[model samples]
Target: MVRLRWYRAAPPPDLPVRQVHGFLFAPDGRAFLRVDGARHGLPGGKRELEDADPAATLRRETWEEVTLEIGAPRYLGYQLVVDGGTHRYAQVRMVALITRIHPVAPDLDNGRTYRRLLVDPRRVGDLLGWGRRGSRQAAAARQRAVVEFALPTLDLPPDGEV
Candidate 1:
């Protein structure tokens, strides 16, 4: 059997940063994102490397925050950021396609709120350009990179179709 391995990276000092985050998109075209109370921003939105394996961290965070089981994920890209002038680190982002996604049962009190929404890739430009309340600048920066690099690289069908 072939051995499978994941890429790893180190974290910067000072800031409370996510080591890695899973960016899961459903066949129906919804993305998974979590609202972090601590940062008052979306948690899984920005990818990063954690003490643990980044892929493992993504799976765990997805289950914990959204209660979704992510299948084997593929490495999509990475994002690096400098925050508070003291903290700097890179976030490894992974992507996985799931068939179905359900809300967390019993709403396990995880101290934060998570909402899964279907987003049109075409509209991503407007969303990021205008920005939302509580959205992190770092996350936005990373997302911009994904939109520029990953999306075009995929060469998927245009909006309202796929």
Candidate 2:
């Protein structure tokens, strides 16, 4: 089992960053992108050597997974992953607004055909399967983003409360 705790900013540069994920919003700003198969994860994966930064990893992974072009992502948070009795890795989770998207296709890395899910925040935990702790952390970050950033420009209510 693993536990994920959310933070508002990137971890110190000295810490080892393991993976990056994005809570990608649709054009409506109500729903988010989710991979259809697998564990119902967000549209992201591990950091790659060619990636200039974590954001780049998100961009490449999103495209490879769902053919979505993301705008500048807000640094929503990072997750401290603890497994068994030891600390494992740090996962960065960004909230990106989707600008444009093309047809879905098989992921270049794993050759799995990934479909998209534009789902409500209340349903994220059920769909993403981030477990109890990770899902709670993700839901909190989503709430914060909506209140801080998306609220001004959006007409909808904040997603499922904080």
Candidate 2 stretches greater than 4 Å from native:
1-3, 83-87, 147-162
* lDDT of every model, 2 decimals: 0.47, 0.71
Instruction: Give the Cα error of residue 88 in candidate 1, in Å.
Output: 2.5
TM-score of each: 0.52, 0.79
Q: Which regions in candidate 1 have their CA more than 4 angstroms from the true location? A: 1-18, 33-52, 84-86, 105-109, 128-162
Worst 10 residues of 2 by lDDT: 153-162
Cα lDDT of model 1 overall?
0.47
Say which candidate scores most in lDDT: 2
- Give the range where candidate 1 is weakest over 10 consecutive residues by summed lDDT: 1-10
For model 2, state the Cα shift of residue 140 in Å. 3.2
In TM-score terms, candidate 1 sits at 0.52
lDDT at 122, model 2: 62
> What C-alpha lDDT, on a 0 to 100 scale, does residue 33 get in candidate 2?
51
